[model samples]
Target: MVIISTENYEKIVEFCSKFKGLTIHCERQLHKKFSDIDSQVLSAILSKEWQKHIKQRHHIILKSSRIYLQEYKAQARLKGDPFILLQIAIRENFSPVSLCRILLSVEFEGKPKSVTNEMIRNPHQIPDPLLAANVLNCLLNDKSDGPITDLKRQTIGEDYEIRLKKLASDAGLNFHDEVYLRRKGYDKTPDLKLAVPCMFRGKIINWIESKASFGDMASHQQYIKDQLLSYGNRFGSGIIIYWFGYLDQIGRCPENKDCIIVTDDFPKKDELVLINNPFGPLLSSNISNITNLL
Candidate 1:
């Protein structure tokens, strides 16, 4: 979830600039390369003669009495198919799936939680909290011949701890700060320390740890309150976020309940902060022109 550094950004730009014709690296493999992606995606990224290519293709199709590419694209969309569009973006090199996943992970507004490797092995069945955590962990801990990856342990148990620490640091949010894990006479200290500006003038605001679901809050309020009390605040806040990926549905922490649920949509109750999505509205508008933007 770390923000892309200028150095990394430059590297990516340089990589894109040098891309060969009609070729791309597949997302599932760092080393595998393929040439059969959407011509549009490839054209968008690597071809300087995209318009000429399109025009010549159109001319050939017209001479042969075949469907025009632009017309075909419109037809496919009208037929309720996103596969073509997705393929084009993926193939033509608009952006790699890895980069998109990285961007989403970077912008995520919730705390990183630990999930089992079994859950990661079968993400389709797990909860969002666990799934997201595992996905972020894998991305952050990906094995490349890089300085950070070289230092990480190979075993899942050791790697989990290492990855979690890295994930917290990447998120710019403390995950284990002031928290401790005690097992058989060994106590492991937290990696992250929650630091938010003091609220109510002088009182330092402590945060509560709880699940990211709206349903979990009503059931788990006492446990969260207890965590808050372990620190020093009767008025501590819990940062709540919805586990569902929907951009329109908002979640909330109860009013005056020493908590704050952060979501993209406004909460029905008080004591929540609504984070804005830069692409949500645009996507909605594109999907349906009737959606009111005003």
Candidate 2:
């Protein structure tokens, strides 16, 4: 069956005529009427047809929402953190152009511990809280994270120490990935640093720091802030820290306005505010859980 319907057909015509050099294809079936346009006129018109098809698909999947949720759920299984799935959901809605800007303004509140237990009970429910807060934050600022991945220079120990000490030296902040830092000399730290909003290269966030129980690290809270502040931008004022688990423990950083800790460790009934970012609010969560993730 033809995916584009008569209702949206005119819109297709307008788009094709507006943009030059476009192509359209249907995976399911061939369009007998498509041949009527001829090769020369077909380019722009077909492109618009493809655009319409994609838009229609985006709306349909988003409308169902379940498909989106399922996509995230599967992603969570791989990441081992369900909340990461929520993060992924947010990413899906972003347009090609606004992605980087969206990534910059995004900062996530860590999940509470109780949330893990809650997931065990009813994993099917949409993580509306995370989605709401993230969406709101995205709208207000425009930004978006996960495991530690890589590094440029310095040893793990030296790199991590530099990152930690550097962040401490600054207002206090750091963000590091696992393989990247651990390889040099740095140990796996649970608390990702948010010392500075901007990085050394003049990038906003520097590293994704993490800490675990086994490793020898500095003071728990103070150390965390030190690492975070160090990573803060040497230029601008936006320095943020994201703690994956335990909200009350981290409470507020030296600059609560700049720091955020998200954990699913809270009571299911607890009221947590979800902030809407530019992309959309709790949209990914709804879509992932309700449609794709299922």
Candidate 3:
């Protein structure tokens, strides 16, 4: 994940907002236009912008489906591109398959789900051959709610967790991962917790968290309230990895007053100064002396 300056990030976000009606095909054009940005980072930024477009225009989409649907359909029919029409009107990247549900719900006299299933599982079974043809073309390109899109996100997230854990292991650090901590009846564990604390950028880091998305201010704040602060309180200190990237001003948030260090990826082995215990030399000497006497 590349660290983007706040000004530039906002500019990219503003640029992306115009692409609400388009799909990732537009993202490809954007990459060529903004070649300096990492493609993955740009995609991550586009993903966030798309989500915002969807949320902000959700009520509008619903309204168009209910009130202005006939007008939208007339325009879609006139233009021969229902998707583009709905997209322009509602400001969302929509699937014709999902749009079929919205259309069938009204047109078929309360019989949408059955046709929706056909559109999904057996498009050939859909009665209208023209619609079936349209569906066949759009279904493969539909990244909005398709399984392929969701699975890629899930796989990326799982893979990053594995990378974080492996990095901890390669550093000769012993740590309990979330699975083990969960089994041990602990709640709110990070991705990994060190057996012995390690110094990272002068702070003793006790745990690590891995995230697969760009950390915008809203999502970052939610994570701080939900996970980061909890991990710090339970484990003393920790690092949160936003593998894709984050807002530049994220480091100055009030929640950062605690020991949660934000990073884009796992640090190399040398970056972490492994410590047997975080206690000072006096405490270590006293423990050694006590053990010797015993």
Among these predictions, the greatest lDDT belongs to: 3
How many residue pairs collide in each prediction? 5, 102, 0
Give a tens-digit lDDT track for model 3, residues 1-294: 478889888888888866644555767877987899788888888877776765675565566675545755465467665244335333445544455445545555566566665555555876755455555555556555444567788999999888887778887788888899899998788888877666677667778889999888888899999988887776676788888888887877777776788889888766776545464443354444323322
Question: Which candidate should be chosen as best, given TM-score against the real structure?
Answer: 3
TM-scores for every candidate against the unseen true structure: 0.22, 0.19, 0.79
Residue range 157-259, candidate 1, lDDT tens digits: 2444454445434433333343443332323222223443222112222332322222223333443354433332332343432222111212333432434
Candidate ordering by lDDT (highest first): 3, 2, 1
Indicate the residue-level lDDT of 96 in model 2.
19
Candidate number with the higher lDDT (1 or 3): 3
TM-score rank, highest first? 3, 1, 2
Stretches of candidate 3 off by over 4 Å are: 66-133, 276-294
How far is 74's C-alpha from truth in model 1 (Å)? 65
Give a tens-digit lDDT track for model 2, residues 1-294: 012233344443554434322122221112344553223223323432444444544554445455545554465456545244334434453221122122222221255544433332232332545433433332333211111111111233344445544544443233343444456565433333332232221223323443311111113355446554443332122222221122233333344234323222221211211112234343334433323211
Decide which is better by TM-score, 2 or 3: 3
Error of 3 at 218 (Å): 1.5
- Better structure of 1 and 2 per lDDT: 2
